[model samples]
Target: MLGRRHLLGTTAGAIATTSLLDRTRAWAQQQPFQPEPGATLRFLRWSRFLEAEDRATTENIRAFSEATGVPVRIDSVWQDDVLPQLSVAAGIGNGPDLAWTLHSTPHLFADKVLDLTDVADYIGGKYGGWYPLIEQYGKRDGRWIGISNLVIGVLPVYRVSAAREAGFDSFPTDSDGFLRLCAGLKRIGKPAGFAFGRAPSDGNSFCHWLLWSQGGRLVDENNAVALNSPETLRAVEYARELASHFIPGTIAWNDASNNSAFLAGQVSLTNNAVSIYGKARADGMAMADDIAYANWPVGPVGVPTELHLVYPFIGFRYSRYPNATKALLTFMLEGPQYERVLQSSAGYVSQALHAYDDSPVWRSDPHITVFRDVAARGRPLSYAGALGTQAATAFSEGIVADMFAEAIGGQVSPREAVARAERRALRIYRS
Candidate 1:
């Protein structure tokens, strides 16, 4: 795996030599792919939260079509609905030729996706290399089944004034301090909140952080079910306590609920991508200046255990225009096209490639810089175990999120919640 140090330490001479060799190999092997005649493509992606991002994507598609003569039709759905749509497509073998979907989608549909190793190789060689964590989502058994596209940094978004009113001069860096801050915010009548429902991104992001930050794992390094442990119980118990300081009805919150609540001044704190802050500033809300960002508090694990939203572009094996799809993806990842999307995202979406780390958009604002290292520091959805069908199944089924929700909602004790989750996870991993 390529760590941050290795990525940063790569010398300019090495990159130039590697790029030359890659170009030579492509020429010798007649690679870089060519679109078949009369080929057209269809692409599906999650709906964009930022207008700039949406416009940039449309512009890129138009540019690709103009350059390659391969007309592309793009469609979008809500983030939570993307996986189900892709599943249906895979089952019927007649959906979009390519999709940009979130974590575990590639693993869940590994057998149905086309191999893109050549595409990945060319892109990574030309633009430094992919981040270490990105490989976990894009590759299956050393075969490239997907291209890791975007890393949505999921961190703490809070009101600066409200935090000061709650007696915090700065955001907390540890779980204990975080709990105190939450309690203080509650006392001031501006409580913190996090999604507990079946929100595909926000719910899983925070709950997984809660579990893993406490040194808990759903599976061991050997992939055995390991959810029933003191660490898990502690995490669940902490979640319960944290929930007491939350706004009412967070249990039913979807992916967009917290953003709505925060902007409406109903919640002082929440965990989300930078979209909340972006929206606030875009619409000129009064609270825009009061908004600030912070990384997740470190728990007993003594490190960052964040699980950001990762979007990977997967191509279905059933597509007749496989070559066109590959070529289009390659076009999108090139420096000019990729930088357009990155600058437009305003740090809402981070790049998975190491070369883009020097993008000026990251430093465009002080609050945005906190998200720059997310792709390097964040963990994959499947932590402490290999990512596969079992891990994907367990996460999509909301096993960990449900465990926290049940305990927080008073339906079960923390220990019982842990036990129930263990049974469900065991059933998945054992199969």
Candidate 2:
């Protein structure tokens, strides 16, 4: 299995072979061309959501088989399982024809991944409504290395009922109201007013979004470490205060624990990604109905709520059947099949605005609306050659979880943590 860190490199040779075939076809264009048959396509997908015997993934695979009359096989695995599988693929050439994983982590696969710039031009030329931020997120060194058919946004997941019970009729649209909402939740015996997990990745998501909303930049347009600024410190201080109201257990919580606590109804508010809604529905948890989402609240600076995003897709880099791959990707993007996947998987929202036009998930779900709005305004996660990965690691490891544990757990001040994060990040950048 390939680790997420190196999954992209897993099928490098195969991509080369596929690119060779594409070039061969290009050279043969002057001759009368006949469609080739018996070309099998394989895909590595997030198996849990769509691969179960009767699930959306399974059905989508079936539909792909029918739509193209080409046999499509998928090696399904859990999202977390992909890294380990890719680790194996890196050693043994047994991975699928295409992989669907996080766009941020695709750098791990950059060497082996196909540059989809031409494919993106094709998709955009035809669809003309793909997520702009996602297109940017999928690129590395000015070439499209991945495609994000789905978009995820970070936001505040709140207990609407709890807020109303606490005498707030509407969700807060700004930062002060958010703090006040937390305070009010505390007054009503929700000891844990809001909670976010202590994973460096989770922290990176929160920190970047906070900075973006406050008119702060992790790196300027020029790409330098900007984590030590007064603006950033203010964001950290505000986060520290919010951490103070987190459930006592968050000190030890990683990604799962925080979501578990939120799921268990121990917390009233959580600033998290939109993926939670799907998880909530899958579990059929009682709190699911009570859960509603809001834009990452505006800061004092009047920046709207921001979200750290994840973009995902299946690319044609290793496809023996480009037409088939294009057909499948296009089908998933253009119709109800795509919506079914998004709704059932509780995955990220589609990057397409028209996707919202016909979606019950967009129209009927409160959380979905906030997520959609954030998508409309948000930028992709910041990346600068190696800086994005390094910063993500630093923020995830040094600042997010560990620092919160130290500061809110009575070991240090938030200021100290931010300074430490800056020093550590600078070292990583310099190194």
Candidate 3:
């Protein structure tokens, strides 16, 4: 029952005889670690991930199933639900072999996830090396707790036509210019929304950008409570100013809100994944032509800083088939499967591995090419600090996002918001 499933597959004879599967299997065998193909792989994926951009991964799942004779069940839930379900599974010590987890999960649940150091090292060595943020998200302490597959490379999705309308022929590349850009957009009734509220995809990712770009950090080198610095106060004040210019209801937006705002012609700019573009292209929406992307404005600190949306693949410690799980992940990351997935997602998914950096998908579109550098330029929320239980807890509770919301909502001063956030950060760090 262990390793016999592939051989006992109903279509084993036919699938086994295919040249691609045969060669892939032989490649699997040559590896120092090979797991017996399991009967089934129960997977829980983020529902947001299954959108049109998810075609490559969705397709490869079928292909992997046929290639390995392993039946895979993929349960798609929203990004918010993924964490709760994963927490329950980890708590009860029983769940899918692999669950879609967020950036800090590998560190937060280090004890509950299967170690994939060997697999990570193998893949990293073969692929160009893993990027910095991948190391922070997937490797906790000294072990690799999960396999990071993609960075939801987020950047400003703006209306090129709107920029021109605002008297700018090109997107601004610095903070001062960005400030003016948003103000101009607001004057034109095309106020940009940055979701100072708790937008999982937009606000969550951008908060770190605002902070880091302004030379502020959640924690210092010692991973202590460092959220109340002067730079952070400036970031909060900047957020407040930006909020005044954002479309109304930004404080309450979720991941989908900004996408809706942009598609509806309500926003001039906002940070997001490529899903908006993918959906527009799919429907041949007229707004698609006006849409364009730009990297973040350089902050006082230096390089293009951002909080990359990192989604990881976690194998539960309760799994009966880690080897099979490893095989599936490895196969998925391999050139043939991964490239298809990236293409299917329409550049919404950027690989953590540098090896795939040359993907042609980036070149296919004039607007999307900026994303090729987004992943490389981004970092996790706990920038300059380790991603662990403390930071994960803080981020999950939306402490940072709420701080901006409160300040922007005019419910609290920027200083007051930073102070409140500081206290919360201390508790989480010391927890």
Candidate 4:
């Protein structure tokens, strides 16, 4: 916990005493990285859900620019658009010099991205260290291709009154109770909904949880296709039942659809990030007081099998100002700058580094506290298999999500859907 006091406390007529500040200063003195003359940096990131977060990031970029005397151009796009744009940039060896990419994206373009091991090592040593699961997302072949930064926690957000009406004293902790709750809600006319379409974060988060919670996986640890199995059939069957209780048009829902439906009171429950709650409170919506969050229900696996969105700061190897890019990345993760962004996010984004666990933001509100352990409790996108090009390809193509959607939409039987998903996984894994 890098508290605000530690970050702001200054020695008599001297610099701040923060360990990150002191260590970074020491490292700079020992091996100063000189930026190329006339270097400018371009950074692309997903547009923020919280306005304060965006403002804080802009401030950090401004401070970095002022300190380094290097002007930086920052661009933001919709969350789903980032990977496709980054893929194009990687393929053509041109575009933004750096980007904050989502899950397993760095793995997909590992060869096109700069090796960030040195940058990762510096930050990890100065801070507590990266969370355990971060290595799975940021590293490949023992080389760090990106700096795992923040995790967007996807959890169950529901209206408290609705849950009470559903006859549950609290949110369910297991799969069977969860289904009953949903069924109860639907009978009462406030059904729960989860994105089943091509939502980059929400769709993958919910669909992957459905599969993993039931002990189904796209691949085995050996990276063999494993989607066509009894476990997968069970998951699809469960999805079919679950989708029947969902609001209509969920099969076409994108990342923003559930957010819209939830906020508009069209759905009483949905799996989403804390941004929905943040938006409710920020806009003074009446439902803000009715909103509460809960951890995803445990399934037959008997452990937490949730997936979350991870943002990694990756620099392109083709960047003209590699040193400057590295410098900017290091600057952002420094305690003061990073802490401000986290604080402003209000727990919508969990820290990727373990040291920030005690940050005041997580404790600021009880409703948001459920997000604090996301990085610790959640699995990587490539769970039960290696995180690499193959896994990235399968995830990006949404094979698992599509399988659930296809089955729920009655385009195929559950078994057929599982077989189709397995066939798709085989194509990618065997390629």
lDDT of each: 0.87, 0.60, 0.80, 0.87
Winner on lDDT between 3 and 4 is 4
TM-score of each: 0.89, 0.77, 0.90, 0.89
lDDT tens string, model 2, 210-284?
555555555555656676677766776776676655556665555555566677778877666655666788778
Candidate 4 per-residue C-alpha lDDT over 345-405 given as tens digits, one digit per residue, 9 for 90 to 100? 8888899888899999988999999899998889988889998889888988999999999
How much does candidate 1 score in TM-score? 0.89
Arranged by lDDT with the best first, the candidates are 1, 4, 3, 2
User: Clashing pairs in model 3?
Assistant: 47-77, 53-345
Ranking of all predicted structures according to TM-score, beginning with the best and ending with the worst: 3, 4, 1, 2
For model 1, the local distance difference test gives 0.87
Clashes found in each candidate (C-alpha, N, C closer than 3 A): 0, 18, 2, 0
Whole-structure CA lDDT of model 2: 0.60
Lowest-lDDT window of 10 residues in candidate 1? Answer: 20-29
In terms of lDDT, model 3 sits at 0.80
Error of 1 at 201 (Å): 2.1
